[model samples]
Target: MNNSHLELLKKLADEFQPRTDVNTRATVEAESTDAFATLVDLARDMQNRLDQQQNRIRQLEQMVETDELTGLYNRRGFLRRVRETMARAARHPENGILVIADLDGFKLINDHHGHAAGDAILRHFGQNLRTHTRADDFVARFGGDEFAILLVGSIPEVAERRISDLEKATSRFPLIWQGAALPIRASFGFTVYNGKSDITQLLQQADDAMYANKHAKRPHSESSHNAA
Candidate 1:
């Protein structure tokens, strides 16, 4: 309890003692009951305020952990979740996969269109991944055109198939803005997590694989500005 609550309680206790000088009277008993009721009211009010404060704190935490544009977990929030997952994995045996994805020709879309269009594309892409993934999976936007997925308890074959399906599904859905259909194509690369490697190493491995995948697609690509 705060000092104010303690002080108010003490004051009430001191002021509302059963009146010994005017005891054996109905008025004195009523006065004592009123004083108890006041204490109860004050305690209830304090508890309500504490609950409101806690709820506000949770809201602030969520805002800080979320990306403003995509409404997905930002890098900080993703990292925190990854750390917690990794720690749990250390204690228990588990298998997971971390995939890093980057939108192909994202800059060209922004250049040909506008930032508004870019924002829409990001939101669409994020929503696509969110709706497709399982409840236990984690999806995050790591700023700009970079996004990630953490597939918990996934086998290598299943994870690969899932990523392939997601890539095809995302490409089929185009964001229509101002009567223009902006196609979304993304390159994804993933690495397995088996409760061993450090976070830095895992991230670097996934990043390298993502770049490699992007490069592999460039040879077969027609135009980088096709999205616009």
Candidate 2:
């Protein structure tokens, strides 16, 4: 019963037993029983509220650490993890690879198909990376069409092969946008970190390598014209 009904019952029971006399013992027992029931109901309601609050907190935590669109780790989350990994690496130095990649012709795609299509392609790319990488590997969309991956316990050669595999995967897979198939490709650059280099330096090196790869792949005529 509701609190109001329980209160009314208690009132009637009290009226029947004005004082705690032995003659009204049965009535007092009934009133006490009703009060205990109300207390039990209140406790249950409070527990439910507490559980709801805990669930909300968990959702908030996930939102803080994850990108809403691609479901990858956000910049903040990625950096935090990098720091932790670096600390561990310092304790036990091993081969770790950092790879940076950017979607080729992404600007054209965005310009032609609009941001929605661009977002869909990015989400697809992120899912592909997650599928190919191991559980120990870290992947995040740095921003826009750029992404970064940290492969733990991997050498430079393995890193290169993995990145090449990723590029092939993306190139072969066509992203469907608005019932149309859209071609996508990516360029990658990677550098191995030996647990002694600064994170910033490692990122810069990877970025430089990515640009070098991009430049190397450009047509000779374009390069010559740009030089002019």
Candidate 3:
């Protein structure tokens, strides 16, 4: 609600309230039937306004947490959820995995294929990630070419297979931009999290593992480039 409407509500509330100095029973008796009905209507109107304000706040929060390009949660939203997950894990005997994936050769693609292709790649990969995961799982785009996935109630072996499936699914459908096919590949690393884990440490571990996986692919990638 606008400030003017808020002030008017306050005024209505103040006008309807029984004064402390007045005799309560006499004040109630002095108010006419029409006055009591008007007071009830005003109270209902104020409640509706308050409900609208709450809804608006929720919508704004959603916008803030969302990534504009990929329609996924942004980093801030991801971290907030991670913290909540951590808190829940502390309270229960649960386990989960956090995966950080970076698009390999993203800078090269952006430089050679232009920003539009880069954006398409990001959007496509993000959608694939969301499609492959369950509704309860968390998926986020942590800006640029980096994304994260949190799989709840998962073991390391299951998490590994899930990541492998995601990698294959994302690359299977190459993005077509400007009548040219642009293949996408991302390196993924994951860390298991439970009640005792720290969020910052978990993220660093996942990032390091992802980089190691990327490095491991370098030899094959270089060989293909040479053959081409």
Q: Top model by lDDT, which number?
A: 3
TM-score of each: 0.82, 0.72, 0.81
Task: State the lDDT of candidate 1 residue by residue for 92-119, as single tens digits.
Answer: 9898999899999898889889999999
Candidate 2 Cα outliers beyond 4 Å, as residue runs: 1-58, 222-228
| Cα lDDT, all candidates | 0.89, 0.85, 0.91
lDDT of 2 at 189: 89
Give the per-residue lDDT of model 3 (tens digit) for 1-228: 899999999999999887874686667767876698999999999999999999999999999999999999999999999999889999997999999999988877888999989999999999999999999899999978999999988999999999999999988989999999999999999999998899999999999999889878887547533211
Per-residue lDDT of candidate 2, residues 1-228 (tens digit): 899999999999889975757758888898999999999999999999999999999899778978878999877777777888888888898779888887777777888899989899999999998999999999988887888888988998888889889988888888988889998887788888876868899899998898788777777766533311
| Model 3 lowest lDDT segment of ten | 219-228
Residue 172, candidate 2: Cα error in Å is: 1.3
Candidate 2, lDDT over the whole model: 0.85
Clashing pairs in 2: none
CA lDDT, candidate 3, residue 17? 88
| TM-score of candidate 2 to 2 decimals | 0.72
| Model 1 poorest 10 in a row by lDDT | 219-228
Q: How accurate locally is residue 6 in candidate 2, as Cα lDDT from 0 to 100?
A: 98
Residue 62 in candidate 1, Cα distance off native in Å? 0.8
